[model samples]
Target: MSDAVEGGARRRGRDETEEERADRMWQELIQEVRVAQMGVQILFGFLLTVVFTEKYDDLTNTDQTIYLVTVVLGACATGALIGPVSLHRIVSGRRVKPQAVRLASRLTLLGLALLLATTTASLLLILRVATHNGFVPYLVAGVVGWYLLCWLVLPLWTRYRHTSE
Candidate 1:
């Protein structure tokens, strides 16, 4: 085992060299990104089609603004989620897999955060249009809370609790 692998080893099962660890992590990260990417793409596509609808013309100015912002956020999330592929393609065979993986991971996290915001805004817009109820904000807030719990809080908790210090 390399000294670096033995010294600051954080993996659960086996000690691995930095390159090996990076490769494994890259694969795992790509898998996660794939799942997230699919959802975001679908959501973004749906958002794109809304602008052409007759109901879009009847929307209040405020609602239109919200829809525009949501669409922008969805676009950003899509870009961020798809960034890793471009990063990999540009840096292929450069012996920078570790750095690439780290950057890609960061991008994926940012993408997910944006996706959460986009979904919240989309939900709020849809609910407002559908019901015009005062409870739309509350409903969106509840769903956002659920998303935070499932996507961010639980993952961090698991990492903190299970990983060695």
Candidate 2:
């Protein structure tokens, strides 16, 4: 029989240590979070300003409710997207980069879901108010389908197609 270290065990390709993997994953996670953070921040800022606009008073009760829901969803998305930064700050120098990256990834995913809801609600409210047509819901549904295709379906497809067990 050959030696355990040299023979039967499968050899890793690059022999990338855990620390190196964590470092690379953290960098990629941070870059992804940055893109999400910018978008959520801008959308949240715009949502906040809407209530102070002159047209705010003219909104019907249903539209106002939709606006409120949209704003709240946006706020939650903002919090979730920003969570990774705070997490990193608190966990810095703890040698738990892998755990941190996993947690941050979860938060980012939650933020994206909230963002999807916020965008859908905002679109529904705006289109209803603008068009006053029976087809508003249909239009909103179409847009939501598009968002799903872009945000969830494609990622999942790529993951399943390319990833190995």
Candidate 3:
């Protein structure tokens, strides 16, 4: 940390005002949220229609329960992902952009977790119904590993590898 960094002239190689940094970060966060929000909302919408399908009645009790949990997770994810917009709207002129960004980032992380659970549960339910075999769980677990590698591990590795002090 240098005086130049603290003086708000430069941070992590970007030279900008505090307000400009906040605005840029806010825009970046919004773009990321839009990507995740669309995904979670569409998944939630599809989950909502599952119970109305004629084939839904054929699901076993266990599968029905899984579907119920998945739908709930999807709903939770949708709410968490959309929460930032409402938060920003309510606090728009409060001069709290920094705090708002932190809170919104947390909400996005929580939403991603919920989305992961929803996706895993939905896959479990679907594979169970489609295969009706003991191997379905193992298959789902492998796919979950893939999701973790793609979604979490790669990003972390990149960050760790490229970050400068």
Q: lDDT per prediction?
A: 0.94, 0.90, 0.91
- Per-residue alpha-carbon lDDT of candidate 3 for residues 49-85, written as tens digits (9 for 90 to 100): 9899998999999999999999999999999999999
Candidate 1 local lDDT, 1-165, one digit each (tens): 223345677434647789998899999999999999999999999999999999999999999999999999999999999999999999989999999999999999999999999999999999999999999999999999999999989999999998666
Best of the candidates, lDDT: 1
Report the C-alpha lDDT of model 2 over 15-83, residue by residue, as the tens digit. Answer: 567888788888998899899888888988998999999999999999999999999999999999999
RMSD of 2: 4.2
| lDDT of model 1 at position 81 | 100
Error of 1 at 165 (Å): 3.5
True-vs-predicted CA distance for residue 145, candidate 1, Å: 0.4
Global fold similarity of model 3 (TM-score) = 0.90
Off by over 4 Å in 1: 1-12
Question: How many angstroms is residue 6 displaced in model 2 relative to the true structure, after the best TM-score fit?
Answer: 10
Q: Give me the runs in candidate 3 sitting further than 4 Å from their true place.
A: 1-12
